[model samples]
Structures are given as C-alpha cells and as structure tokens.
Target: MDAAVAAIEESGPSGWSLRELARRAGVSHAAPAHHFGDKTGLLTALAAEGFGLLADALTAAGDGLLDLGVAYVRFAVRHRAYFEVMFRPELYRPDDPELTAARTRADELLGDAVRPLSPEPEAALAAWSIAHGFAGLWLSGALPPEVGTDPEAAARPVLGTLFPYDEDGRPAAEPPRER
Candidate 1:
C-alpha cells in the first residue's frame, strides 16, 4: 500500500506501472498483479484507504461542517496520492466492490456529519456540496495564497457565513421561508 501511495504521489494515476512498483518494493513484476489484479485494482484499494482516512479525520475534527471542510483540505494535502485517485473514477474501476464500499462509507460519514445541522434532507446535500466545493477550491489553488497559509483559519470566516452557527458553535436553526 505504501509503495502504491508513493508511486501515485510521485507520478499520478497514469504515471505509475506495475513493473516499476515491483522494482521499488523489491518484488517480481507479477507481485502487484497478484495482490491488486491490475492498476485499476490498485487504485481502488487506494481510494478505499483514502475514504477510511477521511472518515476518521472528519469525525475527529468535531467542527461540524467547518471542521469537515478543513479535514477535506487536510486530507488532500496529507494524502495527495490517495486524494488524486479517490475522485477519479476513470482511473480505476468504478464497479470495484472495495471502491464502492469506501465511497458509500465516505458519503455516509458526510451525511452523518451534516444531517443534524440541516432542517431538511436537501439541506444536508446542500451543506455537503458547499463544503466539498470549498475544499475543491482549496485543492485547485483557487484560494488566495494567504488563505492557503492556514486553510482552516482562512476558510472559517467564509464558511461561517455560508452555514450559520449560534454562539455555542453549533449550527443555528434555519428561518421560515416564503410559502
């Protein structure tokens, strides 16, 4: 797994080959195929691992949507290789069982984290979209350099407005809208 991570990080989804991976790990060229079946299999495993890490990090952050956003950016920075493949379904097999399970687990984690703050089911989806959008912006270098200096800190003020919170730091209830 470490070898796969290293190769993906250094090159990208398409850059690494099984032979080079075997060379780095001091194993025969067939070793990776035996373990992962192929490049897609390897990437699927990597995405699963990445999703697990994301779940743990988001759970630990405890800042609700804000913390989840921070964790998303942190995950990208911390696991650039995994992050690169986790979202690129074309790079690997989308139907892989492990990848499917991992994607489900990650989505569930996001749902659990955002559900409480949402007044309606759609609200949870909206919250997740916003958080993910912010994280994507950060990962894509769209945020200003100062924002990147301390991503969490810089993002807080903007995200705070997007997801209103009370003085206690919990998300505030949404107000009534026009009928």
Candidate 2:
C-alpha cells in the first residue's frame, strides 16, 4: 500500500501497475495481484481506507464546520493518493460494501458538523463543495503562492468565510446585503 501510494503520488491513480508496486515493495511481481485481485480492487481498498482515515480526522476535529473543513483539506494534502482515488468512482467499485460504509460514515460526519450552522441541506452541500474545491485547487498547485503551503492555516480562513463563528464558537451575524 505504501508503494502504491508513492506511485500514485509520483504519477497518478492509473499510472502504475501491480507489478511495479510489487517491484517497489521488494515482493514478487505477482504479489499485489494475489493480494488485491486487480488494479480496481487495489484502488477500491485505497479509497475505503482513505474515507476511513478522513472520517477519523473529521471526528477528531470536533463538531465545528470550520474545523471539519480544515481537517478535510489536511487529509487531502497529506493523503494525496487516497484523496485522488476516493472521489473518482470510475476507478473503483463504488458499490463495494466496505467502500460504501466508509464513504457514508464520512458523509454523515460532515452533515452532522454542518447541522448546527443551518437546518437547510444546501448549507452542508455548499460547505462540502467549498472545502473539496479548495482542497482540489491546493492539490493541483493551482492556488497562488500567496495562499502559502500550510494547508490547515490556509483552509481555516477560507472555510471561515463560509461558516463564520464568533469567539465563543457560535455562528456570527451575517453582513448587510445590498438592496
């Protein structure tokens, strides 16, 4: 898995093969195939693991939407390989039980975090879109240098813009709107 992650990071999700992973891991060329069945299986496993890890990180970030958004970005930047594969369902079996469960757990956690901020479902979707969009931009190196290299630090302010909170951790007042 380490070799696969490294290969995915260095190249991409489809750039490397099981044989290459085995070679990098110092195992027989057939080892990865024997363990994971095929590239899709391996990617499926990686996606499941990635979602599980993401769920853990978000849980640890507490129930705050801003903190959860930061955790999402942090997980993406740190686990680039997993993040790359997890969202691209074409690369893996999205209906796989393990993968579905993990993905569902992460989704539930995100929804729960956003619940207090707004009762509307759109709020959760918007928050997720903002975080995921920012993470994708950061990972693709499309974000400007002024954004800096610190994923957490950069993410906090941007996420705060969406779900602003006061010092006591309650949602802040919305700014006046133009007529």
Candidate 3:
C-alpha cells in the first residue's frame, strides 16, 4: 500500500501498474496481482482507505462546520495520493461494499455538520462543494500565493465565508456585504 501510494503520488492513479507497485515494494512482480487481483482492485481499496481516513479526520475536528471543512482540506493535502484516487470514480469500483460504506460515512459526517445550519438539502451540498472545491484548488496550485502554505489557515477564512463561527464554535453573524 505504501508503494502504491508513492507511485500514485509520483505519477498518478492511472500512471502506475500492479507490477510497478510490486517492484517498488520489493516483492515478486505477481504479488500485487495475487493480493489485489488487478489495478482496479488496488484502487478500490485505496479509495476505501481514503474515505475512512477522511471520516476519522472529520470526526476529530468535532461538530463545527468550519473545522470540518478545514479538516477535509488538510486530509487532501496530507494524503494526496489517496485523495486523488478516491474522487475519481472511473478509476475504481465505486459500488464496492467497503468503498460505499466508507464514502457514506464521510458523507454522513459532513451532512450532520451542515444540518443545523439549514434545513434545506442544498445546504449540505453547498457546504461540501465549497470545501471540495477549495481543496481541489489548493492541490492544483490554483490558489494565489497570498493564501500561504498553511492549508488549514487558508481554508478557515474561505469556509468561514460560507459557515461563519465564533471562537466558541457558535455560528457568528455574517459581515455586511458591500454594494
């Protein structure tokens, strides 16, 4: 798994093979195939692992929506290899039971956090999109230098714009918008 993560980081999800992963892991060329069955199987496992890790991170962040958003970005940047493969459903089996359960867990965490903010279903989607979009921008180097190298710090204000909170984790009043 470590070798596979390294390969995904250095190349990309589709750029490496099971043979390459075996070679990097110092195992026989057929070892990865024997264990994971094929590249899709390996990626399915990776996607499941990524979602589980994400759920853990979000849970650690507590129930604060702002904190959850920051945690999402932090997980993506820290686990770039897993994050890359987890989102691209075309690369793996999205319907795999393990992957589905893991993904659903992460989604539920996010939805639970957003529920108090608005009763509307779109609120959860909007919150997820904001965090996911910001993470994608940070990973792609699309964010300006002024955003700084600290992902959590950078993410806080951006997420705050959508779901403002005070030091005590209570929702804060939105700032007045300019004409």
How does each model score on lDDT? 0.76, 0.89, 0.91
Off by over 4 Å in 3: 173-179
Query: Which candidate tops TM-score?
Result: 3
Model 1 spans with C-alpha error above 4 angstroms:
119-121, 173-179
RMSD for each of the candidates: 2.5, 2.3, 2.5
Using alpha carbons, what is the TM-score of model 1?
0.85
Residue lDDT tens for model 1, 19-103 = 8999999999999999999988888888888888877787787756766766776777777888888888887888877778877
How big is the RMSD of model 2? 2.3
Candidate 3, 64: how far from true, in Å? Answer: 0.3
Model 2 lDDT vs. the true structure? 0.89
Q: lDDT by residue for model 2 over 10-128, one digit each (tens)?
A: 99999988989999999999889999999999999999999999999999988778788988999999999999999999999999999999999999999998886677798889899
Candidate number that wins on lDDT, 1 or 2: 2
CA lDDT of 144 in candidate 2?
93
Point out the worst 10-residue segment of candidate 1 by lDDT: 170-179
Over 1-179, each residue of candidate 3 has an lDDT whose tens digit, in order, gives 99999999999998988888898999999999999899999999999999999999999999888889999999999999999999999999999999999999999999998887776788889889999999999999999999999988999889888866898665666522333
TM-score for every candidate vs. truth? 0.85, 0.92, 0.94
